[model samples]
Target: MRIALFFALILFHFSSISQSTDERAIREVLAQQVECWNEGDLECFMEGYWKSEQLVFIGSKGLTYGWQQTLDNYKKRYPDKSAMGILSFELIIVEPLSEDFWTVIGKWNLKLNSDNPNGHFSLIFRRLGDEWVIVSDHSS
Candidate 1:
């Protein structure tokens, strides 16, 4: 009976590890976003987002449609190094929406020489091709 129980525990542990592997992959994607932002690489940062025209990004100014529009907006709003100082994200929630989708809720903070701007953001990510990319983002 003890041996059977041990095997059951081992199986449970393996299942838990398997489940967490996906979460870890999602987190790695998130971490790459942070690293790219910190490095002041907007293009690299944009890699985390879906490249399709259907991708959406909502911000204080309003909603932006299309990946180019989103990139344009980012360039306009953070026009210089001073404005784009440093970007950091504090993940508040991360949950699997389905086998290939995830919902992420977090706070984004930017430190600038003039002022620090921070807001809450929620993003819907989907596993596309070989990586996870944001399909939709809403920030306030």
Candidate 2:
């Protein structure tokens, strides 16, 4: 009985460690995106997202599918640095849905020359291969 209990505790410890590592990785991806956005590099910002036709994004404009489509929409809306502005994010929740999936809820703010536009976002991240990438995003 003692041996069984010891093994269970070991398993729990490893599981928690894995989850912590995954959470840190997800946060790093968001940090990279913010840095890319602040630098006015839309392409670089998109590196945080999953580059696939299955990718989905929903915004004030409505539902958009595919990685290229999302990038196109961003370009259409924020054509210049003034429009893109400096981006910041406030994460409220980052919870794991399963071993390979996680959900993030956060507030995003853009500091522009004209005005600041802020909104909340919900993102679903999936572990694909060795990297965690945002597969779906809903922002308004």
Off by over 4 Å in 1: 1-15
lDDT of each: 0.87, 0.96
Report residue 57 deviation for candidate 2 (angstroms): 0.3
Per-residue lDDT of candidate 2, residues 54-105 (tens digit): 9999998789999999999999998977789999999999999999999999
Q: Measured by TM-score, how close is model 1 to the native structure?
A: 0.85
Clashing pairs in 1: none
Against the true structure, candidate 2 reaches a TM-score of 0.98
lDDT of 1: 0.87
**TM-scores for the candidates:** 0.85, 0.98
Q: Count the backbone clashes (under 3 Å) in each candidate.
A: 0, 0
| Model 2: ten consecutive residues of lowest lDDT | 77-86
